[model samples]
Target: MVIGLWLASLLLALLTLLPLWRFEAWWVRGLDFPRLQLAVLAVVIVVLQLLFTDLTQFNQWSMLLISSGCLLFQLWWILPYTPLFSKEVMATAADSTSPCIAILNSNVLGPNRNAQALIDLVKQHQPDILVTLESNSWWQQQLDQLSDSYPHSVKCPLDNLYGMHVYSRLPLHNASLQFLVEEGVPSIHAEAELTDGSRIAVHFLHPAPPSPSENYSSEERDAELLVVASSVKDVTTPVIVAGDLNDVAWSETTRLFRKISGLLDPRIGRGMFNSFHADYPFMRWPLDHIFHSSHFTLQQLQRLPSIGSDHFPMLVRLCYTGRQQPQDGVDPDQDDKQLAQDKMMAQAVAPDQVHRPETQAVP
Candidate 1:
């Protein structure tokens, strides 16, 4: 029994430490998804080692110390998302006089048949903007019903799972699809004019995930996100970067993205609001996200009901007011900028990817 427990401790310790090394290997980076689960197990082991085992033993001492440290680190990273910590983005009343922009970001699995569920969500929430990832031609046809409600739009209905579509009630200017890091993968960039005549830049992305079947490493995903971060760093306009980031809120890449781009995650004080793995409640993490600028205060950040996809839709209602006080932002240091630049340069671009996808105005 002691040997078996020791083996488990060693395995857990290794898994907990793997993501800290900045390894791009899919298996290593994949460890970032289960910090909560691992922390729970680590604490249990620590308790067992302390109460039931002989801590004087060298192996027992090592196990207890390692497990306790892992638990502390994991909790430190996730504590911000819990209600116990202060909110990173300030919240305001949803019905305030300031112009509110509610955005619903959904990754409607390309073949999922429950289109009405998503449609119902959109109708019920009536978000000013709707961004859908993994949408194909068939999904586009199904989502056409939304056009009557969201007249202004952009669509890239590729058969590839990377397909994306954006529908907005507000007028969108210079909306274009950009293939940032990988061929055939596209991200959307646009300026949305809010009701108060103020414009905020919105960048929607769904980069490929690192997996055995997908991209072998997270290089392309990290590069695409960082490249966007680099582009948005200097913009004076209010910005909203929202979509299925295919990354967790606490991942190093995401933290780096926030630091470099100077974006704020509404979920910091809100909740984990896990949006992916809708089918498996036990194996889930937040993959869908909406990171915005300090120009807007969060009115509501909620996880909408699942729409028969692996990912549940996220509703972020933000109030845009020029008077909203600037919140604390992460200033990227030289090392962060250098790391981002290196990742961007590492992603190999194809010949046709040199130009942005032609701007297609949705009628």
Candidate 2:
């Protein structure tokens, strides 16, 4: 029993420390996801060790200290999302003419067949703009009813599962689809014309997750995001970036994106807002995101009911009065920026070499 306890403690300690390596591998980057779960597990293991074993040996002492350190480290990363830290985006009074826009970001799993449920959810909320990820032609067809409400749209349907569609009630101009990093993975950039004739830059993204089925490394995803971030880094107009980012709100890459793009996440000091793995309540994380510039103050943020997909939809309402004072998020240091550049370099392929076999087939 003592040997087993020590082994478990060592394993837990390794899991805690593995993310510090700054590797782009999926398994390493994945360690950033479950800090809350890891903290709880570490605490429970420490308590069990204390209750069952006497702390006389050197190994026992090491186990206790390591487990406690793991708990503290996890809390350090997670506590900000709770009420302990003040909200980065402040709430502002909004009226009908506040130039407000409500956005719905959903990742309807490519193979999931519950299209009616998502359509119903869309009708119920009536968001001003809706961005759907992992949406193929079938899901797009099912969502055609939204055209009457959202006249402007951008659709890129694919079966290889990086498909996306953006629907907006507000007028959209200069809308074009670009394959940011990988040829198959597309992102939408456009200008949204609000009721008051003000235009706000909108970028919608759904980067492919780093999984066995997808890319083994997170370099592509990180590059795609940083590319967008770098493009909009110095934009003077109001900017909003929203979609299923396939990343947690507090991750290193996400933080770097915020610093690079000068965008603000409304989730800070709000809640975890875990929207992924909707079927498994215990194994969920916040994958969907809606980030806006300081010009907009948050009006509402919600994680909507599951539409039979791996991720639940996230809805955010922001009132764009003018460019408010920029709020602080995780400000990336020099190392962060360097790491982003490294990831981008690792994933950067020449245009002639850009042909992915999966992307060759007509969708």
Candidate 3:
């Protein structure tokens, strides 16, 4: 029993620490999703080890300390998203506010037939804009009920599972599809005209994820995001980049994205609104994201209930202050800029690395 406990502790500790290396392989990047889970499991292993093992021995004490150390490392990253840390997006000091835009971001899981669930939420929330991912032609057809309500829309229906649809009650100008890395994969970009006649530049994406059955490395996903991040820097108007980012909120890639784009996440200092794996509570992380520039303040951020997809939808309302507020997100260094440049430069997106949505090992 002592030997068994020590082995489990050692293996668990190694798994927890594997993500420290900046490797893009799917397994390593996948490890990035389960940090909270890993931290919880580490606690369990530590408890069992203390109860069953002889701590005076060299090997036993060493394994216990190593596992405890790993648990702390995971917590360091996870704590920022909790109330224990400072909030990234705070309420504005001014009582008089600019126009507010409510956005609902959902990955409708192409094959999932329960369209009414999402539609019902859309009707209830009445968001200013709605972004749907994994939305194929059928999903798009099912969602046609929204056209009368959302006259301004952009539709990119694809069977590849990277399809995206944007329905907005607000007027959208220069709304076009952009192929950042992969040809079939598309991202939506537009300038949303608010009721106050101010425009907030919006970028919506559903990038291909890193998975054993999909892209083996996160290079393409990372590169595609960096391409968008690089563009956000050029826009003078208040910008918002929101969608199913396919990366966790705490990963190095997402951190780099936040830094490069100068966008703040409302989730920080609030909670990890783990949006993915809605069916399985044990294996869930924040895949759906809504990020905006510092000029906006968060009014509401909520993780809506499941819509029969692997991911639950995210609803966020932001009050655009019409002028620049303090920037609370991470700042981009020269190295960060150079790294984003390199990722975009190397985006000769490998053909084999890209896979269809139907091929994903969806549970």
Candidate 4:
């Protein structure tokens, strides 16, 4: 019994410390996703140790201390998203003439043939802008009915699973498709002209994840996000960055991206809004995201019903005041900036240079 307790405590401690290392390996970086799960594990282990183990000994006491610390750390990272903490994004009244825009971001699993369900959601919500990832030519044909409602669009349909399409009710100017870090993975950048003649910059991305089948490391994904973040760091226009980042909201890379870009996540202090893995209720995380500049105030944010895809659609409605500043998030320190630079440089190789392995239908 004592041996098992010690081993369990040691394992929990190691898991807590693994994400602290700056490595981009799938295992190391992937540790960032389950902070809440880790917290629960730590609490349960601490309880078991206290109830069953003899803590009179020095080593036993030390183990308890380490486990307690792990619990605290995990909670610190997670509780901010719960109701216990104040909201990060300010809420205000929304009106049609005041630059209010509703956006829906969905990662329609490439092979999932349930188009009617997604189409039904689109018709029901009637979002002003829709961003779909993993959308190929077939998905395009299924979603073509949206063009009648959303006149402005940027489409890049590819079979490689990184295809993307953005449809907007507002006018899109200077709409360009970019292959930031990887060629097959495309991103959208454009200026959206609102009904009142106001404009905001919109950047849509669906970066690859750090999995054995995808880029072995997070170098390409982190680089793609940071590269886009860096480009808009000094832009004066209101900005919105949306889509499946494939990274968790609390991950160090995502936090750094927010700081460098001076953007805000509506999920903070609101809810996890876990969008991916719609099939599994237990194993899920917030892979899709919507980050906007402070000039906008949130009116509504919701995780829509499953569209028969692996990911749940995320809908956000925000009103641009053009005066208010967004809530500040974690600011990237000097070391964080250096880390981003290193990751970006690591992806400097040609996209084709990275071996593309056959992947399952999950993003």
Model 4's TM-score against the true structure:
0.93
Query: lDDT (0-100) at residue 209 of candidate 4?
Result: 97
* Model 3 residue 194 lDDT score: 92
lDDT of 2 by residue, 185-219 (tens): 88888777888887787888888888788889888
Rank the models by lDDT, top first: 3, 1, 4, 2
lDDT of 1 by residue, 136-176 (tens): 99888988898988999999998879899999999988777
By the lDDT metric, which is better: model 2 or model 4? 4
Best by TM-score: 1
Cα distance off (Å), candidate 1, residue 68: 0.5
Local distance difference test, candidate 3:
0.85
Go through the candidates in order and give each one's C-alpha lDDT.
0.85, 0.83, 0.85, 0.84
- Model 3: residues with Cα > 4 Å off, grouped in runs: 92-96, 348-363
Q: Count the backbone clashes (under 3 Å) in each candidate.
A: 0, 0, 0, 1
Which one wins by TM-score: 2 or 4?
4
Which window of ten consecutive residues has the lowest lDDT sum in model 2? 354-363
Predicted candidate 3 versus true structure: per-residue lDDT over 214-275, tens digit per residue: 79999889997877776665455688889998999999899998888777888999999999
lDDT of 1 at 142: 86
Q: Which candidate would rank higher by lDDT, 1 or 2?
A: 1
